[model samples]
Target: MSSPSTLSPWRLSVAPMMDWTDRHCRYLHRLLTRHTLLYTEMVTTGALMHGSELRHLRFNAEEHPVALQLGGSEADELARAARMGERWGYDEINLNCGCPSERVQRGAFGACLMAEPQTVADGVKAMRDAVSIPVTVKHRIGIDKTESYEFVRDFVGTVADAGCEVFIVHARNAWLQGLSPKENREVPPLRYELAYRLKQDFPQLTVAVNGGITTNAQIAEHLRHVDGAMLGREAYHHPWLMTTWDETFFGDAPAQRSRDWVEDEMVRYMERAHAEDGCPWYAIARHMLGLRHGLRGARKWRQVWSDHRLKPLPPREVWAMAQAHVCNESDVLVA
Candidate 1:
């Protein structure tokens, strides 16, 4: 491991989701589990290059041990963007080559870059040279129909040579030309065996598996073969699943929070959103909708806050509604 201090000891992490894993989501996950590494939504080099500081890069320092994921192909541009991440106290810089969105393809990045491993190697090298923090890669096994495991094997070999010590592999093919980004996430068949093989072949690099990983058992199984696991949709939809991660994966102190306590914590965060310009309380609350999943009255809890009529209510009041729903469930069951 290149500077194990720079990388997360948690090993298990949350993937860099597009719209779903924003600052608010990251904050919520951080609250649930103290040790799991979190990632920012993939911020393009163009956005970081020309956009406002607060909009493009501002994040609460509480969201530390966080990696800032970047989408770009230019070496110099990525290097400059990486330095900005370092300045902003981001723990790692991750290059994205797994996304299959058309917009990303148009930009000559994302899964399309899989065909250009040399460019990715150059970008990784440039970013690695520019920042003291670890520069990592989150990518797919192959693009389109190039299903050969050797292809991914070589991709890791080439990039790993450039000092990119960590690889978060989405264990699936990206049908770059035909599938919509959402479809790409689903339609492709997963080949986890290949990811395990990559880990075996490249023992020196920290290989983490992503894509459709949901349960603690699955994580433990993958960890047997690979160094880590990255959760995506599962973490977003049932975030409470992360409650065990500290003790289960990272070997840290368990987070001391009840469901009610978590709702209370949201009230404080909501106040922060209200004080900050451009942050809507709902932007933060939307991520919390899943916080109550599988609990009694979760539907009422979600419906109460998700209702548009509730939109005009104050942040504290919205949280109050969620609390009331939880209380109501307890009352009914007790009766």
Candidate 2:
């Protein structure tokens, strides 16, 4: 069949979360796995046009191979926003067509764009023409009850013609009318085979599957069918899951780092962020509360870092408090 999929950067990645995949969150994830691509939160074209550019686009130099995910339907605006992403040093530009949130729909983008493939093609072509970096699309298999495979097939064919070589398929139908965004993620059944079929049909394109994949074994399975597998909340809540990705998926020698070391490194980043941006340490610390997931005393440790009272204290000091919970079993009396 097609050549093996592991050679591409899109082979493994974290989905672009809204408020959850901000720069600080990306920094923490980068520390866990180096090769896996990271995505910025979905920033609207309007925000880029009228809002603070630095606040929307600035990212750490360390977050390389990272993509800027844009939300909008207008061709000119998407092109301009994409140029800004390229100027800011982003490695790729991804157009979001899978989001089902009402707010995004009201803005005339997201999964609603799936209903208008030509508009998406226009945006993709504009962005592709505007920047040298790769332009990709993240979308659902279908919208509402349009379960016929032909619907998604045409969508891919049209966009692929416009120059998008990489597609991250969420593998579920987005019911735009009856469900909340949270419900959309849960109520829809995942049809990963549709994603596999897209890859089979367009062997020249890079196709990755995302949605309800919670474990590395699951990711490995999807990889067998498509070019890649992307984890969303699973990666965010249990980031340690990514620590093994370098060796397990990318064929690197075993990583020489540990969770404790990653936590220490994050503390240093916090100091620099606070000193430079005047950001509160707690703002950064909140992202790593899941760092200790499933481990002994994880709950208590999470409680320590997430405690608002600790905002007055430095990150290192808050770190010490969290460590105490992991170290001193007696602290279990209260989180």
lDDT (C-alpha) at residue 9 in model 1: 51
Predicted structure with the largest TM-score when compared to the true one: 2
Model 1's alpha-carbon lDDT is 0.87
lDDT (10s digit) by residue, model 1, range 1-335: 23334544537899999888888888888888876889999999999889875777888777877999999999999999999999988999999999999999999999888888899999999999999999999999999988999999889899988899999999999998878888888899999999999988988888999998989999999988998899999999999899998777765567777878887888788887788774677778889898877767888989987888877888788877766868432343322
lDDT of 1 at 57: 81
Query: Candidate 2 at residue 147, lDDT?
Result: 97
Error of 1 at 227 (Å): 0.3
Q: State the lDDT at 220 in candidate 1.
A: 90
Give me the displacement of residue 32 in model 1, in angstroms: 0.4
**What is the C-alpha lDDT profile of model 2 across 269-329, one tens digit per residue?**
9999999989998888889988877667888888988888888988889888888867432
